[model samples]
Target chain A: MSDQPTPTFISLDDAAAMTEGTRVTFIPGLQALYSEALKNVCFVKGISLTRALHPPMGIDKETGEDRQARLFELTSQTSLPTMFHDDERPRNVWIEQLALAERVGSPSAPALIPDDVAQRVEMFGLCAVILGEDGMVWNMRIMNDGPLSRKYGYNKTASAAAPAKVAEVIALIDARLKTQAENGSAYLVGDAVSAADIYWATMSMCVTATPPDIMPVTAQNQGMLKFFASNAKVPAIAEVLTPRIEEHQHYILKTYCETPAVLGGDPL
Target chain B: MSDQPTPTFISLDDAAAMTEGTRVTFIPGLQALYSEALKNVCFVKGISLTRALHPPMGIDKETGEDRQARLFELTSQTSLPTMFHDDERPRNVWIEQLALAERVGSPSAPALIPDDVAQRVEMFGLCAVILGEDGMVWNMRIMNDGPLSRKYGYNKTASAAAPAKVAEVIALIDARLKTQAENGSAYLVGDAVSAADIYWATMSMCVTATPPDIMPVTAQNQGMLKFFASNAKVPAIAEVLTPRIEEHQHYILKTYCETPAVLGGDPL
Candidate 1:
């Protein structure tokens, strides 16, 4: 388990007082790839966090207002993983968080982004493939939504493109692994672990779909997890994911994400 | 210019006759990124092509039939750049075409895919980012549609995400260039020009719109090009296109795309 203090999470209603000096994030998806990734990054860097619940479906229980709408009002986006720090500007998006991990992290918990210019470029490029709109998670979401649409709701034509897009991304990650293997280093960019590694390690769960033991999601969210897991289980896409990636996943969980990522918490 | 013969294109009706021995592609957008890139690949490899027009708007003027529907009947897809060859399965998508370019290309022309496994994987991965549904062109299209929705017609929410997605893709290409600069190579993947180079050189026109003299489009298509250029012109994405990418563009165009890409061609 990471030596960092267990993060104190607050209800959205209680977030006002905590926002004064604390680092806060409006987060959702008790078991989301992006959400878990963000929490893991905080744990690795030993950055204490105050989490404000942005419910998975965007609806908050107390306010009955769409948390996504609230997020958009504050951060101009509905996406999760928005970090608000004291005094300085709010950091949104996965890339910004990676950079923040570097800024706030001590020497012992070094930044995931590499120092080499080329590696940095590679890291950013890889992250874009995973985090960008047409990226792995986005494709995975579409795949999840497509099936769910029949049972719940979706745009069939648009969602039809998800599998191929997801396949393309997984192939890219596999290729990166091949290159890393040739270089005799297991990491994506260079010899050391970088943001690319962290992002992929967590985001890849969109495909591999780990059990609840490590990434603990509530029973309420189990259906959503199945959606993600089934999306990843597509044969063509799943085949592209070599054992090399699973090795990285194991390494990441063992090293940085050993602490169980349980759902829900009390106010600070 | 590539030493290959100037290809003779045909209408959808004429495509049936040439299906026996000739390599054919269901193509649209006279100066379209995918269409032109495919043509350039064939030209470089001395592979003669029989082109069948897939009307950009998906409606055929001559028969008043939905061309996309017609394409789907042939290949189960409406996307352009689908290639039909003699006695083999149809090749669709950019990845398939890249693989085919190697099989059909001559010793003199050579495949655009790199020989190095790592480079090949990178090339495929990068190409996926371009050709995949969420790649640059897809994002550009959405951004174009979003603004055009007020003036023309489009899906607004989908289009809103375009600029950022396009920016992410452009950033990746720029990062590749930076890494190439370090290795003393200008190409996106390896030392030699690969399919990745050709695809970007042409597809990027969707962003950095080339002048009419080189990539001549119909007056009707001019608006589309403008939409793409303006989308690329967004500061976040435009700033990523460094001098290195420009150098490669110049190299690809001077070497492979010297002939003006006029808007339409006569049927053979």
Candidate 2:
């Protein structure tokens, strides 16, 4: 076999082969990484990093160090998830991979993550982590648990962290992405697409759908929409996700969303 | 002839092609843009831009936005191009482009520079700008006149005020690329290559050659090497740019240093 054309490891990057084995650039498959006693699974650790770059912990380019020092004091008091540990169990593989990458110097570069870029990358990494940790499992969760959570979920909201307003979430994403598209700057920056864009895009699929026309879309939305609608999920969930959260939403809507619908499949 | 297919625009990614133009992307053509005069270039102006973000400015992750603030202030202090025109020569097209990009919003977003991926895009853009500005013509002057005097050259020493120590410049770029490569982070940030990496690679080539084995060797080197070796340059330029000073000299010596001698075409 070694002499005769050994099968080289090749990761597919196309629409049809959704299989986890396929090396989806910028996308990782959680199920493939998990087996029987799946522990130490890490995901969404960076979702909040973007916001973290805003105040004290994050250096404000305008005010200088004094503002950073003060911001640090404020953030220190708050219970923020600078580094989030997904779920009750630890996904050993991710930890091992991270360690191995660290040892091999193949993990993402911490230095490359300049102050601003770090915040953006961390947030995006979290999005990737979540997608990798759960993959379609998230879709299943939304399909199965979403409606039940939404229909009976009502509680008194108090304090500042009263969960993000769903509508605001959508609008925020819309505004950022719209600017990104308009400015021709990939992410929030000049010409590069930061982790924020990727994270938003990935996590976003959990809430909304990619546009079909210029992005990754498929023939799956019909039934998928019905499934999501019937389950109805959390109102916040619906409120947070909308039609054009990211320019790529159209792509997802067109590609992945439609696949299941054409196949007459449901979230389950 | 008119119907010769609407000439689809493809993305060129090859280092050389991207430096100039290829299939999928059209960059490195900043020189061409200068010749073509891209009008009304809508752009996004980023507030907290940095070196990894903008090669022209170098890195500035400091909390005190003093440096960038000064840069902004300098621009504000004087009109575009420092308004030192002799009331005759038509404005420098390259400067016009830069000013135009800033005016229209930066031709792109808030985070115009992406967080991670390939580092070549920004470098690529800057290369275009440098080429567009006919930086070589000025560099040639830097070689002959040093960093002083008007007849010394055209265009402010791009980095005139903040001239990098030859060794420091070399070390900085080498370290930047090496660190990124070691991390498997595409050596640049974004969905693809950034102009920053291209700038480093090209500039580095001007100073020294790498191990042909390590770096894909091409005949384009001879012309480039000869250009730098010409006594018509900076003493620091020659000293720092010599083959002996090359960080990858051994890599080149042991691998591809002389391999190009056997090749035919120019080391473009």
* DockQ per model, Cα: 0.02, 0.01
lDDT by residue (A38-107, candidate 2, tens digit) is: 1111121111110112122344677655433432232221111111122111112222223222222224
What TM value does chain A in model 2 reach?
0.34
Two-chain complex of model 2, DockQ on C-alpha atoms against the true structure: 0.01
Residue-level lDDT tens digits of model 2 in B157-228: 543521233333443445544665576644334433332333333344444433444233334343434554
What value does the lDDT take at residue B114 in candidate 2?
37
- The whole-model lDDT of each prediction reads 0.63, 0.30
| Model 1 regions lying over 4 Å from their true place | A1-8, A13-29, A55-67, A146-154, A265-268, B1-268
lDDT of 2 at B237: 49
- List per-candidate RMSD values in Å: 14.6, 23.5
Docking class of 1: incorrect
Q: Work out the TM-score per prediction.
A: 0.50, 0.24
In candidate 1, what are the lDDT values of residues B89-199, reduced to their tens digit? 455556556556666767788567664444554665576567654456766766653432332224677677667767777777887778887999878887788777888
